[model samples]
Target: MELSWSTFLLEILNFFVLVWVLKRFLYRPIQSVIARRQQDIDARLAEASAKEAQARRLQDDYEDRLAQWRSEREQSRQALEQELRGEKARREKLLAEDLEQQRARSVAVDSRRQGEQRRQLELQAMEQGSRFAAKLLEQGAGPETEARLLSVFLESLAEMPEARRLQLCAQLRDTPKEAQLQVASAYPLDGGMRNKIEQALTACLGRPVACRFTEQPELIAGVQVSMGAWVMGVNVRDELQGFAHLAPDSVGG
Candidate 1:
């Protein structure tokens, strides 16, 4: 077939028109749809990224809270442990102090008991010793013993203070003028002894006092001169009684 230029040009123009129609109608609309889809995808990706970031932040916050809780728990545990230790220490100190006090009290009680026992033993010893001495003196009572005691008694009266002697003299003088002074002895006194004793009594009284002699075995080897309510004697029994009142050390001495 012979090539026709008009026909060829017409065909080319139809092809261009078809291309233009496709670009304006189908291609443009498809491109717009694709752009919208791309925009949607981009928006979805950005939202996913934001969500992931938020989740990470939440996870970080949760981890921080757990760590803080653990720290607080540890601190509380330490505080409780410290309190228990302090309480234990305080209780131990109190117990120790109480024990010491109890020990001190026990020591004091024991000391006091020991002291009382010692005092009792000393007193018992002193009493026994005094009794033994008195018994010996009583067993040895005789005329010679009575004479010696009488002499000692007279010497003791002579050595008495001037005021005390005068007071005794006055007291004896106040008795009834007819009242006889009695001289008692544990042993029999001979006439010579009686005369000597009478002379001594008269000298002591500063007057001739009425006198009588009597044997009283209870005198325990001593002479007793009695005038009215007054009586003076020196004997083993009186010495033993006086010794009973002495301190243990003095008795031992």
Candidate 2:
């Protein structure tokens, strides 16, 4: 290639002009588009970070609400258990009191019934005793038995009062006027029962009394004085008969 000063100058000027045109028209517009794109990318990243923070806050809130509900449910369960236990204890106490009252009532009823039974038995025994007493009084005296007759009469005479006995003696004195009657015999007339009877008759009659020496085996063992229409005899047989009528339970175990 041949080097010429004018042709080299003209080539250098054309190269400079082409670089300025590219910078002003094509390179500047391209650089502006790239910068705008980078700004958009940064805005998108900031929006993503905000959304993540909001989601975390919502999750925390849900967890707190669930914990509170669980706490309330446990407290309610414990309260219900306590109420049921109290009710059961009260029921048991009531049942025990009822049973004790029933037991006391039963004991009282049994005791009253036993007392009634004992009283009934005693009444029946008393009725039987009265009937026996009437029967013994009906059987009268037998004759020819002096010792037994006197014993029977003496036992019957002892039952009367002293005033009533004097009245009977006065009646006897007026009735039998020479009847030579014996009056009251002395108690426990030991060995001289016959002599005592004769003396009493002598005094009541106002005359001498002849004593009879007759033994009456029919009479059980007592003095009997008889002077015409008036006779009194005490007999041991009547005593034995009265005792026989008593109930076995009254005398035995």
Candidate 3:
């Protein structure tokens, strides 16, 4: 129980020594381990931040590519529509041209058909007129008509060209001895008429020429004079036939 200063001082010194040993060995090594763990955590945080930045850049690039693809697709669709419209317009034009040509051809064919029909109708009318005229002349035949025709015949002979008259005269004179001079008339000639005809023939030939007279009703209303192969006459039948032949040209003109 009495106070001991030496022992007390000794105990205090022992406590200080224990404190120094713990600081130099145990506390310093544990503090170093804690510092290294903190550095590893900081490095991991930095690496995570870098990876996030790279991912953001890749996302932005992908969005840009998608927008470009959409623009290109829209342009292609517009170009295709324009081409289809042009093709349609071209087809319509070709169809319209074909229709016009067909219409023109049909018009031409119709015009030609109408012309042919008109020509045929005109020819038929002309034929009918010719027949009517022939019938009228046949019914009107008479002595007066016959006498007029005979006078015309004589006048025609007198009006003949001088060369033609001379040629006929020469032909008559040089006729074969056995050949007959024939005179044909629509009506029978009386003795006085026959004598008159013989006198005219003799004067034209410059010689007495024997004649044979024949009554032929088909002469219409005229007289025919024949010597060898030569014959001369005028009749309504010849005029009608000439008119018939010329009718087509008259209608066309």
Candidate 4:
């Protein structure tokens, strides 16, 4: 083919025109579509990243709440355990105190019982001793010796206070109406006893007194004083009876 300047120029113009049309129309529109697509993809990627971040935050929050709940539960459990332990300790203490009190009460009761038994034993021993002494006194003093001793004792008693002497005189009365004092002896009246009787009667009656003695063997070797309704007899048999009354428990022994 032979080259022509006009043809070549036309071809060149055609080529440039195609390029301008593509650039001004097709190329520009396609480029705009591509740019918009790229923007959409970038927006989708950003949204995805944001959602992932939100999910991660929510998970962390849930984990934190779970941990807090677990911690609270553990604390409550520990506190409950401690409360139970304290209650158990308190109960044990109370039980111990009760047992101690019971033991103390038992000890006191036993001690009291033992003391009572000891007192009873002591009383029994005293009674026995008194009886033994009485028996010995009975065997030692006879009727005659007892009479002589009674006369001396009366003399001493008469020398006591005036009230005591009057009381003696009153006790000698055999009855309430017989207030006068009288002294009588089965044996011969001794001067000493007679004088002592007179003095006692003089003091008792506040006047001169007289005492009579009659020989009566049936009265035994003793003196009997009668004052009205009252009569006092000094005899070994009476003394023995008084000794028996003093030690009633030891009488059988």
Task: Report every candidate's CA lDDT.
Answer: 0.84, 0.59, 0.80, 0.69
Tens digits of per-residue lDDT, candidate 3, 1-253, equal 9879998998889888888888778888888888887788778877887888888888888888888888898898888898889888989988998898888888888877886678678877998898898788889977788888877877776577778878887777668655667999989988887777777766665667778999888777778888768887766666677789888887676
Model 4: residues with Cα > 4 Å off, grouped in runs: 20-30, 126-253
- Write one digit per residue (lDDT tens) for candidate 4, span 113-217: 886676667656666765665566555645566468566657655556778667765654433432344665555766886777667656654556566655554
Q: Whose lDDT is higher: candidate 2's or candidate 3's? A: 3
116-143: candidate 1 lDDT, tens digit per residue? 7887888898888877877887787777
The CA lDDT at 149 in model 2 is 54
In candidate 3, how many Å is residue 45 off?
Answer: 49
Model 3 weakest 10-residue run by lDDT: 171-180
Q: TM-score-based ranking, best first?
A: 1, 4, 3, 2
Candidate 1: 10-residue stretch with minimal lDDT: 244-253
For all predictions, the C-alpha RMSD in Å is 6.0, 14.1, 9.1, 8.1
Residue 232, candidate 4: Cα error in Å is 16
Please tell me which model should have the higher TM-score, number 2 or number 4: 4
Stretches > 4 Å off in candidate 3: 1-121, 170-174, 205-207, 246-253
Show pairs that collide, candidate 3: none
